[model samples]
Target: MPSPPYPVNADGCHPDKGWTQRQAAAWLVQEESPTGEVGFVRSTAGFNGPLCEPLTVQVQFWRLTYRSAAGAQARGSTGSAPDYSFTMAAMKHVQLRVDGRRDVVVTPPKGYYSSHPSPCVGGLVAFYTGGPLTEKELPSRIVSGDSLLTFDSADFHTNRVIDSKLSSPSDPAVCDADGKPTRPTSAPSFPAGALLPTPSYPPIRLNPTHT
Candidate 1:
């Protein structure tokens, strides 16, 4: 929402993408009712320390109209249709603020009518700012902590938990590279070069269910 020093000349008139040098100078100088009129100034300096050129604002009015159905008689008349309409008054004004200070009043020229309500019922006041000001103008960031209490604890516990009682020793389980059992493997094997134990069988018994 940043704005240039002056209103942009959409027709490629201003070279700096801002106010032209002449426009800036005119804004700096304050003038009375140059045409010997009153109510608003013709031109003035803007809040951004630049000139604001004179501008004309237009207002309009409207009314609602109604028509009866074709060939329909009027509500209280014989064989005649009736039409109705109503008028509403609305107004709009275009003005400039100088350096965000002072409201100069100007009188509209002949043909300007205030009694007839304008169709556009609102006022427009434009001011210049470097850009839209933000209430909270800061960037955001996030910080995180390590999951492990210590590097050694993470390294040792991770391997031990993986090797416990669920994997083969040769398959990266139960021991480190030197084949020492720092953790228990799912199945125990005879030590390297050691004889296998004699095989023994256990008795099995079934328990009755009491559902």
Candidate 2:
């Protein structure tokens, strides 16, 4: 699998505590694609598990897939970008993917809010306010590597903002449901969102069809 666009710490925390708000603002500025190219960024989240139950978690996944007003003029396509936002109120987990190769996880600080910057000209933003989740709480598909998609490094660059509130670096150990530390035998698997609903545009396959 390809590495995430953002910097991931040993604890599987993207951005960790070193990333700052200023960095996030700067990253929000989209970079122009050379060949009128396009790419995508993704964010996933899960809920209704052991941590927070009874009530489902509400989430908003945003995507920008077209050229901005100014961007369209420069491209000479006379086309403006469209905003793609998906809201999931009740689900075990949700995975949002764009039309590119880069997969990103939007992780904020322990007590602060954070967003992920998209690698493509028009990117995706992930935002959610809920209790921190554990690996077991993540969707079964992601844990089993059924929905985890990998793409080429050159295809996308997932730029994410880091939280500056952290005083010390994060611990490398992956935490369990009870808040205990557990070392992984291999590379740690970050949290992933579940499948997306069918949209008007072409849908990216989250799970591979079995033969």
Name the candidate that leads on lDDT: 1
Please give the CA lDDT of all the candidate structures. Answer: 0.24, 0.23
Task: Put down candidate 2 lDDT per residue, 1-211, tens digits, no spaces.
Answer: 6644453344333432332435333322122222221222332221101111111122222222111111112122433222111111111223332211233333321212113212121212232223323322221111111113521111111222211111110221233322223453333222233223225323222221111
Winning model by TM-score: 2
Worst 10 residues of 1 by lDDT: 159-168
| TM per prediction | 0.16, 0.17
Q: Report the poorest 10 consecutive residues by lDDT, candidate 2.
A: 47-56
Give per-residue CA lDDT, model 1, range 109-180, as digits (tens). Answer: 232222332221111111222221121211111011112421101011111111101001121222322334
Model 2 ranges off by over 4 Å: 1-55, 70-120, 129-197, 200-211
